[model samples]
Target: MRTDYPYDLAISDLREFLARRVTHSNVLSEFQEELDSSLKRKTVPMRFIFEKFIKYTNEHKQFVPYTKDEEDMIDDLFHFWG
Candidate 1:
């Protein structure tokens, strides 16, 4: 498969290849299940995602849920003032 080709089919083929690499075997079926599950729910906020990541990285240290933009503003103010 020439991945550089243009078409909806090309994108589909690329997705199939990535799924094969990520899931190992049963690529199509496993991703179909994941896609179905994702379609069934709303996406979580980045703050929530960061909190979970911080917990994992910090070995259960509690995370304050601050969004990225808010954190950036705080950093900017502190950088200029302190």
Candidate 2:
């Protein structure tokens, strides 16, 4: 069936795929691009997105590994929102 919420389904599916592809620093930027124009969200925080990515990568092995150092850097960069 054709639905008006393809972007929503795509985002949910992409989130799973992104768990295996995106690097640490690109998380926020990717999330921004994912929702930009295609979808609308209510002010999702950097920390929220970061934590979700972190949880995803933790559960699976990614093609792009997110090292501990990069994680710390992301924490510092977004700590205000964290």
Q: What would the per-residue lDDT of candidate 2 be over residues 20-40, giving only the tens digit for each residue?
A: 456665664666575453447
TM-score of each: 0.23, 0.34
Question: Model 1 clash pairs?
Answer: none
Alpha carbon lDDT at 53, candidate 2 = 68
Deviation in angstroms for 35 in model 2? 5.2
Error of 2 at 64 (Å): 6.1
Candidate 1 lDDT, 1-82, residue by residue in tens: 1223233332343344335334334534645454444335522123432343344536635344656654563343233322
Name the candidate that leads on lDDT: 2
Q: Per-candidate RMSD vs. true structure?
A: 14.8, 12.5
Lowest summed lDDT across 10 adjacent residues in model 1 is found at 1-10
Q: TM-score winner among the candidates? A: 2
Steric collisions counted per model: 0, 0
